[model samples]
Structures are given as C-alpha cells and as structure tokens.
Target: MPTGPAATAPRGDLWRFAALSGVYFAFIGYFNPYLPLWLSELGFGAFTIGALVAVQSATRVVAPYAWAWVADHTGRRIRLLRIASTAACLCGAGLLPTPGWIAPHAGYVGLVLFLMFMNTSAMMPMAEAALAQRVSTERGLDVGRYGRIRVWGSIGFIVTVVAFGFWFDRMGLRWFAPGVVLILFALVLACRQLPADKAADEGAPAAPPLRPVLAQRPVRWFFASAFFMVLAHMSLYAFFSLHLDALGYGRDAVGLLWAVSVVAEIGWFLVQGRWIGHGTLERWLAFACAVAALRFAATAAFGASLTVMLLAQAAHAITFAAHHSVCMAWITRHFPGRLRARGQALYTVLGYGLPGVLGGVAGGALSEAAGYAAVFWAAAAAGALAALAAWRVGQAAHKALSATES
Candidate 1:
C-alpha cells in the first residue's frame, strides 16, 4: 500500500466523489434499459442487437484490467478517470448527429460503440478502488461510509431511468443520445472536483504475483460463485422488459418493475452497514447466493403475475446489493494497495464481463429455442450452482476462523 502525507481531506471531497459515482451509475441505468431500444430504432434485427451488445461485454474482458494496470503503475487514477469521462462524453455526442448518422450503418455503429463502451467500462472498478482506499485511510470514516456515498449512485440511476423513460415516451428516442452526452459532461465536471489521494502520488507498492493470489482457496471460490450468480442474472438483465411486454405489460409498467428492484437495492445499500457486522463474510455470501436462487426461481415460475413479480423484485436487496457488498469486503481484506485495482478488475471480469458475454449469448439462444421461461429456469440452475459454491466458501472460512481461534 502507498502511504505518505495524511491530513484531514475535506468532507466535501467525499461528497464530490459521491456525485461522480452517482453520475457514473446514471449512465449505466440509462444505457442498460434504453440501448436496445435505440438500436432497434435504427432497424437492426434481434441477432444484430445481441451481437453488438456482446461486443460491449467482450471489450469489458480486457478494458478494465488494462486501465487498472496503467493507473496502478502510473499512480494517476484521477487523471485517467478524467480522460475516460471526456472520451465517453464525446462518443455520446458523436452519436447525436441529425439523420441518425450511425443508425443507418448498424455494423459500423456497433464497431464504434464497442470501442467507446470499452473506454467507458473501466470507470466502475477504478472508482471502487479509489473509494475503498480513501474510505479505509481517511479520518472520521470507515467502509460503512462508502455505502452512504454509493447510495447516491443508485439514486442517480433511478433518476435517469425514470426521466429517460418519460422523455422517450413523449419526445421519442432521438433525445436519448444527447441526454447521455449531457450527463457524461456533468460526470466530467464532477470527476474534476474529486479529492486527490496522496497514496497515488507517493507510488503504490508493487503488487504481489497473481498466481499466489488466485491460488488462495477463498478467492477461487468467490470468483466461481460470482460467475454463476451473474450468469443467473442474464435473463433478468437482458430480456425482463420483453418478457413483461409479452405478458401484456405496458412500457410504463416495465419501467416501474425495474424501479422497484432498484429501490429495493438502494434500501439494502443504505442499511447493509448494520448487517455487515452481524455475520461472517462467507455466511453473507451464502445468503446472497441463496436469495439469488430464489429470485431467479420466482421469476421463472411466476413472471407474469404482478404480485409475485413485485415480491421477487424485492429480493434484489439480497441478490445484488448484499452480494456486492460482501464481495467487495472480501476483496478489500485480501487485496490491499496496488493490488486493489487488479482485484476489482478480476472481480468485474469474471463476475460480470465473462458472464455477460456468455450469458447474453446463451440466454438469447435458449430463449429463442425454448421460450423466455426456459431462460429464467436456466438462470435458476445457475443460481443454485452459485449457492453450492457459496456454501463451500462458508465451510472453508469457518474452518479457517476456527483454526485461528484454536
């Protein structure tokens, strides 16, 4: 870990950090729900859309680790963050020319978008590393404080989702690209205002070799479990709205369903600090995996029922929020200093990027063959496997803790 001058960094810096975080997630909230719609507006077929989205996930497999390595070696996280924010904003603006410049050329557009999103995708893992460092070292703060700041990101996401849904309904998809550009610029300004970390200036210690870290049994299990858990999410993330529409729900209703899940996730972020101290990390991970199993199973079985859907959506608190918090906590414990960024990148690659690419492709194929219901059932099986992995993690952790006590 890099250590140098430590003075009271202003609380305002933390708040600005929160703002930056919020702006970052707002981009995702808008993109996740709206990107396919925007692509379809350009007359691309479903297969083309799936292929293009896979390009984004494919980039993620390399982009975040590449960016983190540069930041860790150069020790200039904020500078890199600013560059990424600016580039992504410009990319968003480029998509907004009249007559829909990129829309008419779907393959060309996908190529350009793949590059743009790759640049943008590194932001989340980098931001987490930054926040974890500051939260751990700064006075009058702890890991719990990180959640308070992160909740704003969820709030920002909700704001954009609701706002874009309404505007897209009224004015049409033409406004989507420009709206994203405006938000990205706002993110740039927020990034500029973030507090400087002295550790980045002092130079991070050389990270230990990766093989030993991966060789750790807990780390291996966590990654395996995360991969399966995210695989279970493929159907929900990619086709939930279509499933709802197929069952006779309106656009507004679909939006409301998503909002409910996000709201539940936010609630968990706000309250999870209290829960964090109450259980072992392995137990929490197991609980999250179990809930994920239930959440996917419920969606598979009762997706069309409004009441059951609401209840299943509420499990987002456990499925995503609790799972994420425990995973980050585990990483923070295992990987410190220069290693934090790499650890986060590894988590994102296996936990999100790999599953996103594989799951999106597989889910698309399976849904086409068997129906959307089968997709969720497959997701349920993935979640069950994740639960099994988590249980093993818990067993190993409990044995370790017992050995330490003895």
Candidate 2:
C-alpha cells in the first residue's frame, strides 16, 4: 500500500478505495430508491415515508461533523470507517422481523432507521476525507484520477438499481430489510479491506481555525449554491420513484429510469477530466444548476412520457456528476490537510443535510396536497436559485483572487 499521496499510491491501493466506494454506493443504490416504496408497502402514507427518509438526512446534519471531528483530531479515519460500517450492519438487522422482533410499525421503523443512518451517514465523509488526501494536489483535486475511482460508485448504483428493481418486481418488497442487511454487511467487509495507516498528523502543528475559513465570501457563496442545488435534488431523492409509481409506472420502469440517470452519471465521471478543465469550477457549477432546472421542469411537466423522462434523466451527467466534481474540487482547494474531513462534513451538513430535511418534509406535504408534480416545480425553482448563487461564487472568487494579486 502506498503511504503517500494518491499519485504515488499503488494501483491496488487505489482499487481498494474504488471497491469501497462501489460497495458503499451499492448500499445507497437500493436503499434510496426503494426505501420509500418499501415503507409504502408497509402501509405508511407519503408524509410518513418522507419523514422516515428524512431520518437519514437528519443524521447528516450533525453526525458527519461529529465523526469528522474525531477523525481529524485523531487521524483514525479508516478505523472509524470500519467501526461505522459494522455498526450500520448491526442496526440494519433491526429492520428485519425475525421471531420476537417488533412489527414494522411506523415508530419502530423510524427508530431503527434513525440508528442505522447515524452510523451510515458518517461513513462517506470519513471515506471522502481519506480519499481526498490521496488524490488532492497543491493545485487542486486530480479530477481525472478522482473521477476514475469515483465512477465505480455510479456503476454500483446502476447495477443494484436495475437488478433489485427486477428482484422487487418478482419477489416483493417484503425482502427489503434482508436486502439492506446484506448490503450493509458487504459494506463492513469492504471497510476491512482498506489499509490501516497510522495517524498522519500526530505531533504535527495545530490546524488553523475553521471559523476564519468559513468567513470567506467565495466559501459562503459556494455553500449557498450547494444548498440550493441539493435542495433541488431533494425532490428527486425523496419523491421521484413515488411520482413515477403514482403515475402508474411499474417497479421495473422506475428502476430503469433511475438507472438511466446513473448511466449518464457514469459516463461523465469517466470523461470529466477532459472537459472539467475547459472552464472554472464555479462556472461549471452554475451550468450544472441551470441544467438541473431544466431537468426537473421536464420531469414535472412531462413525466408521463418515458422519452421525456429519459432525456431528463440523461442530464444527470451535468446536474449531478459534474456538480459533484466541481464541489469536490472546490472543497479540496478551500479545505486542505488537517481541515479536509471537517470541510467534507460541512458540505454534507449545509449542502445535503438541511436541504434534505426541508425538501423531504416539504415535498411530502406538497405531494400530498397538490400532487408530486408540484414538488418538482418547486425543485425547479430551487435549481434556478442555485445557478444564481453559483454565478455569484464565480464573481466572489474572481474578486478574491484580484485582491490577493493586487
């Protein structure tokens, strides 16, 4: 195993990280798209399902930072990753109804999910922090190398989404709990494969204060853009499957739609290195948000048309994959070395956490009241706002650069 930067890391070590990403996202692939459907099958209303799904986001609000603080301070990221994945696997068993297990009542289910998410939610930030340390350079993240490894996540997602779509279609969603447990078990095993290195920062100088970094104008605008961009995505994450199902789409069709988006996402990650350098990360972020607006609008207005939905899903290349790469680049540049873990955690909190809570709950109510289409309309509006914020990020970054140069 290479103990140095990702550039110097052996190919096998990089592949291990790729394997971990693949399995971790494989767990997410089935869980995100199917969890609501499974809950609905258990007779929970849309509002209840939304709230339950929001439990994961709720954990993201505080859990990642808490975990990151420990990782940063102790430099025990891989150890924590293993522990978290093991805990998540154990918590996942609570979802099953073995003899004497509690029934899948709403409260019981929510509690189990909450505990499970508390562990699982922390895994990504820790893992990303570790990986970023390898791939990042003084200039920024090595977009191509990073994308090559990250692309495995999209591959895992698509594989499970499509396969389990067929599985649920044939075997019924009663198997959802078992499937979750199995994936989590896989996650635990993957974590065990990661090389355990000693603390990188032991006896090193103290990291700079975090507050001053947060105070920068470009950072503020960048987070603002992330908030709205993810807020826009919340509609899809929380309700897109339900929306398709409500429109009479079958489980197989719903899964295929999701797979379409992942396919596009995979393609972008595979080639993003070539295109990402053509413009500034901030500019790319703005373009991605603009595409997000258009994507959601199509889903809202023409969701019943498979062709339109497929086209909309294809834009995931830009809206999700590209946007994520840009954000990773920005985070790598803004928060380097000792601050890396917390920076990724903060992105989880502001970018995905708060927005997810709002989008899930509000979207649920909006779907229950006006219909699922209304939620997408609102998401479209949010995407537009994200584009504006990202544009401001570009302006702020340029101004900061000029001031520094002068």
Highest lDDT among the candidates is held by which one? 2
Per-residue C-alpha lDDT of model 2 across residues 1-406, encoded as one tens digit per residue:
1122445656787898999999999998988899999989888898999888899989999899999998888788999999999999999999888223665688888889899999999999888888887777656788888999999999999999999999999999988889989999999999999978545566556766699899999999999999999999999998999999999999999999999999999999999988989888898999999999999999999999999999999999999999998899889889988898999999999999999999888888889999999999999999999999999999999999999999
Q: Which portions of model 1 show Cα errors greater than 4 Å?
A: 1-9, 97-99, 137-141, 199-201, 399-406
| Winning candidate number (TM-score) | 2
Q: What are the TM-scores, per candidate, against the unseen true structure?
A: 0.92, 0.97
Error of 1 at 72 (Å): 1.7
Predict model 2's lDDT versus the native: 0.91
TM-score for predicted model 2 compared with the true structure:
0.97
Deviation in angstroms for 292 in model 1? 1.3
lDDT of each: 0.78, 0.91
Tens-digit per-residue lDDT, 1-406, candidate 1: 1123333446787788899978988887887777766766777655566566666677778999999887777667777888888887777676676335533676677666776787788888888887777776432224366677888888888888887777777788878767777888988898888766566445656655667788877788889999999888867777676577678876677777878888998998887777776887788888888888888888889988999999998898888888887788788777777777888888888888898888877776776777778888889899989989988887777777788899
